[model samples]
Target chain A: MIATDPTPADRSLLATLDRVLRGNFTRREALATGRIDLPVGRLIGLCLLLGAIYGICLGSYSAFNGTGHAWLQTLASALKVPLLFVLTLLVSFPSLYVFAALQRLPLDFRNTLKLMLLAVLVDLTVIASLGPVFAFFAASSTSYAFLLLLNVAIFALGGVLGLAVLRRATRDVFTPVPPGKALEPAAPVEPGATPPVLPPALSLPAPSSRTAHQAADQARRLLAAWCVVYGVVGAQMGWLLRPFLGNPGAPFEWFRAREDNFLVAVLRTIGNLFGR
Target chain B: MNFATDENLLRGGADVTPSARACLGVGAAGCALAGLGLGAAAGDVRTALFAAIKVPLLIAFVAGLCLPSFFVVNTVLGLRDDFRAACRGLLAAQATLGIALGAQAPMLVFLGASVLDPYLLTLCDAVQFGAATWAAQRVLARHYAPLLARDARHRHALRGWLVLFAFTGVQVAWVLRPFRGTEGFPVQFLRPEAFEQNAYVVLLDHCLRLLR
Candidate 1:
């Protein structure tokens, strides 16, 4: 079981989530000290809440357009969106944890879990914040293809931001810098002389050892592999829980016939939207 | 309150808490004055009264609907502590919009008096509203600059709020229709089919018709 810290008044789950997004929790000091005190349980609750908010927006498309009992589609979507992310994480997280252990990275299983949850929460929060926009468009547009395309675009944006934060957090937490190893100070410029321009290639620090360089490469490869796995699993999970926006012509169903994959469906939708 | 000494509104300073009432009063007064000029296009007193009521309503109603979501976003992004400052800035921005509208009211009035074509009057009203919105955005940017300097996330938050505000504003304006009364149609607060029609759907239909 992961150790629990005393919940302080100031460090509410919302505030902690905020700090995570702002890159505060990923600072060298916080990572080095192993002081990430995220409330996992409360955060899960927050994720669910955020997901439900966005789901309602997603469902609004159906509510406005779908035939038969459309409100149920909204309710079903609210329940399914959070489930989609959680299910995807469950499917993909074990390999990530095992990879971290193999690499002897700083992240233990618990921290890995926390980081994953934080990333998912970030994704959900962003999607929820854009709920109003989605609802507005959903209400305004009658075309099912247009709404589907718009949703894909919104989810893509959320996924990109979430992955970026995850990458940054993982890098900061896993790579421990030795004490007293700091960036070289800039040389003072002579009075009235132009400053030297450092080449972009020369700006980055050289790896101190061959093993460190290998480890860094391995970590980057692992992160890339894991991101692909997560994204694929997430897309498939969303596909499995189909009918997010109930088709205007058809009656509402929780899941549609799972014939095509996400990418194929998206391509078809784009083709249909543009009359190609 | 003395308008010039209202540092929060005038200078975009967050040190002092700007009065909410002052912001609302100024914004409503200015927009209402502009509405009076707009309604004069039809030379009808009742239409003028209706326009005065609706112009402020359009501004306030849109703001009201968009603010709750913005607050939630700000809280999650850890800007809750600065919520009051942000709100003050927003209100000041609204006040700026009102002032801009009020400033352009005389021009609208002049156009109303000189122009006989209903299309020209409608075009003039649209131009003034667009100009006022542009002016309001300048004030909003000025007020939000300090917050943006403090945290870059404010930039996204402010941008999101503006987009939501504009989206909802367009819909609300559509629903509260007939700002420039038709020459023959009886003057009423709203068109008979206001609620039934949506701005985006109508625009889309028009586009499709054009293509055909």
Candidate 2:
């Protein structure tokens, strides 16, 4: 009976996950008017667990395509993708915070970290959702290159969608309320951003539809920027954890030299086209 | 309501936030020193010295090149407002690459000393450099993300800037070779000044030849 009841933290984590999977966020008004606190640690843990599961699922392709100790190599592939995404996000967080401030998104460091982590979390979930389809294709496709390109395309599609939701959700949820006026205040107006025509009463951080739209608009571009940053960061992480799709002939390798960098890989692909 | 545009796009030395400056500046500088140390661990002391002095120069020069291109691209793209911030942001981000790499310096040196195999050492270098580059890009994107609300095209152009920066950085590295002095070759700062072998083309050839 005691074991049957989930802890309060578990409940919170489950609630956040439910919200995220719903593919929409709390309305800006609701988020601002009502409290938008989240148990960020638990939520992130859920996100990583999901991401690793998906990564492992996707890593099955490496095992399918590679030879000689392919199973062991597949395990490495599984470990690498999650490691790559997670490590890159952690390493680059400070800069992300600085950038957030620069944009006057001005996410408090803690919230900003949570928002970014959540974004990545969302991305991994979306990718994982496609895992079954990808695994199916990997099983059928004999050409390693074809499968690799297809997986990359799928991952990109997932990333685009995940980021869209994150942008909308984080904007509404994380936009700060004025000091001491969480329940009733005017929309957040950056100092000198708006003309001072409104009455003193309007200065409070109240939930206005117009302000909600404005806030969402403000975060749209920043989210767009994050998409690119995450993409590049993810790519670099992937390169380091190479042999994602093993060449059919080569024995399984967990890591490859820098010879497979974007520049080299791209050029080689192009060159093969011209030479053959 | 207009967004906050501080009249001075470029904050001066005095105006620069100490934390931001320290994070970026020390990071970039440390990466340079560590790069040499890592290179030295791979081969000989002279090679290490060459790497130490030059990798930082490579990072700075590449970042310096990015500034003008960023300004020109933004101006051409009708994003004049973002030019100053973009420039400064990149400078800081470039420093971040150094910081990220510098942080890993100890681990890299340990690997270099312990692993005598050149192939393994090369793999280590690749991993560290790749991770560092990713971290730097994350920083740069952070600085520029909010500007995305103003113009979506800027994101496209910013990405272009990244590709340009990366291609140029890699080429510069190739041109100034012997960062890790080949064990058998005489220790020289430069790779004996030969005609630049197109690294990409060479890679392409290797793969194509392997198949044949």
Candidate 3:
């Protein structure tokens, strides 16, 4: 005789994930169906003002230090060059635009903020690890390590404060119209009057098992794709820089060659490694 | 009779759909592989310890970025899957990347220093600014853009970009300034090397040139 089985916790967890994904997709659909009522110019102006303030703060810090001719100052000056800044901006803009588009979908601010922080944390990890390597290569001794630490610390501090301020300000500025305002208050029913009946089809559907399987599959695919892309890119970079690997200053001078030979050589080396 | 039939059905269902178990098994295997790779690459206990310290940081980063997405996706998909598991997997991936990048830091630093030769610090400064700005932009665009769009607060987006630009700007200025031989206070703060390292002194000397 067969025995009865208990519902597993994993089943419930999968069901919950499915619900979230569905909610976001539904919200996106709703927004697409709704009217666009935002004032673009005002928004742009606000952004510009904020940018100006930040710029002023940076400039003030530089001027007050009296060491504007120092290493930090030189770094800051190099960043001022339009071409370099623009190039960096261009590469990242598309990704930002996609993020903005995602934001248009209804999601909780708390959840969004959490994700942003996580991303920043990931970036910090990369930077921190990269820092020591840089110090080592630059032949920097113990004294210079403090500078690296300070730079990293300042950036991290700035990020935390910025996120806090942005969250508070956004909440105050973007109030949603209450549901009562959105729909005319249901005509006042007489005392004990029968409540308006909802259609049977409008009732929540029973959660399906099929949806859970599908979502898991999608997530797996996305993760795999991400891994592949990053892996390929990393490998390519490593290969291109291989010949210069053992050379004392090859990594530094690799970018200066006008001919494609250097890149070709690196690529061939990578190809051979992979081929093996 | 009804109870007996229901029990049979449940048993059959469980036996037939083992994908969750399979997925978990695969995930575990992938993690093991990653762990092994890290161990081999590190070679010794001390190196492993240093790398291990970065693991929590790596987890924090991945969780910080992907958790929301995981929640949102799960919510939208109506799946009740384990959010923690997803987070763990992503964090592991991030840690691997962090380790890989860390391994190469020495080379990058050396390259950066080489670029500092012949007073070519200006070019080195430019590269750092360019790379950092590029990275910052990518983060803002990929990670922060959605929140800005959702809230209709474009200011956050602008602020994000400006912060990155500001960072790059500062680095560039510090690299290119004409300092003959004295260590300017800012130079002291901004030196990218260890205090005892001659590179710091050399960099400080550059800052002093302007003072003279």
Candidate 4:
């Protein structure tokens, strides 16, 4: 399915990324095309670049403050930043595609993957852009608690914005395509009672149609539920892949033993910051 | 362009974008001058020289730290087209800050020389900095007026930038400390434990102390 296109000949990878960053891809007209037309491989590559940028910034705190193996800690962080998001997406994507299909939404497996990657691209872009701010604070401030909280806040902001982009795109997806512009099915039909197995000649019903309305409502509900699930998965993924911001007091290690969860660590950090 | 004669800096114009290089140069020079006045309070030329370098460095660091986040925000809001203008506005504001401070330098130096109590001298210097900051903010608003007219989203972005810049400026300034040299201590570019402390934590500690 992925190899059908020869190459995205017109747009360079950087140009494609620039368009996405400027939100040209998420516009209603663009979304109304009924499939994310982004080059998935390039999107993944861009996501990695953005993630690594932020990761290096994250690691610089350790590099400047740690006792030893500063460069190794930085290298580890650069690798892990992309891994955190990509791993979480890989882990959560199968269920996302299945649930989206079962809900009879417009997305196929490939389209679903594209949308997920697009959402992640948005998240990582925002985080990476704030990399300088993070590095600056890391250099200037000694309070580990403050840096931890700042990182959490940044991630939260990125996540919220990314989810909003996803919501907007998904809303457009639920709308029936304009007359005669019926979206080409990206995948073979699932055999058993799937709406995707459309009667080939029949044009999609108008916006007022009941099935379309029901599908939109279903998509909304699914999106809300999926957001919670994605957040949980992402947080846990980050927790499991610990030591992204290497603790200055500790020697460099690739991963910390999984002891406490993300929530507990955040609360404890807040407490420590406030002299509790 | 010529900031001194540019009416756009006083009354915002969309077309008249200030020269970023010129703004930066003027701002740094003005800030360096202000630093000399500030360090003169220590009654030593050596301290004055240190302050001269650190003041501009502090401003540059704060702005540099905040720029990426600001650029991304503007881009996301579909205001990337006006980014050059927005940046020019921001730079003009920084230059205004420097110009305002520079204008106050002679008075600050006079105040430093005249004041008997070191605490009073510090208080007066703080008040001057606050006043200059207020002036700079006014210039920023003038610069931002055109942008706000173009898109209401610019308002949010402007507010966000201000909060971010101020928060970062405080921390950067704290880390690049001893702008005002302490009595009986050797003059140094930074306090020996400069990076060992965090400004927000110190503020929290002070607030807790007050509560106690």
In terms of TM-score, the best-performing candidate is 4
Per residue, candidate 2 scores C-alpha lDDT tens digits across B38-82 of 776655767787788888877776666555435434543446767
Per-model CA lDDT versus the true structure: 0.74, 0.61, 0.32, 0.78
Q: State how far residue A95 of model 4 sits from its true place (Å).
A: 3.2
- Residue A89 accuracy (lDDT) in model 1: 85
Question: Which CAPRI level is candidate 1?
Answer: incorrect
lDDT value, candidate 3, whole model: 0.32
Each model: TM-score of chain B? 0.91, 0.82, 0.30, 0.91
The iRMS of the candidates, in order, is 4.8, 17.4, 15.9, 1.6
- Give the TM-score (0 to 1) of chain B in model 2: 0.82
RMSD of 4: 6.4
What value does DockQ give for candidate 3?
0.16
Lowest lDDT sum, 10 consecutive residues, model 1 chain A, at A196-205
Residue-level error in angstroms, candidate 2, position A255? 1.6
C-alpha TM-scores of all predictions:
0.76, 0.45, 0.22, 0.86
> What TM-score applies to chain A of candidate 1?
0.81
- Chain A only: give the TM-score of model 4: 0.83
Candidate topping lDDT: 4
User: Candidate 2, which segments miss by more than 4 Å at Cα?
Assistant: A1-16, A23-36, A170-217, A263-276, B1-212
Among all windows of 10 consecutive residues in model 2 chain A, the one with the lowest summed lDDT is A195-204
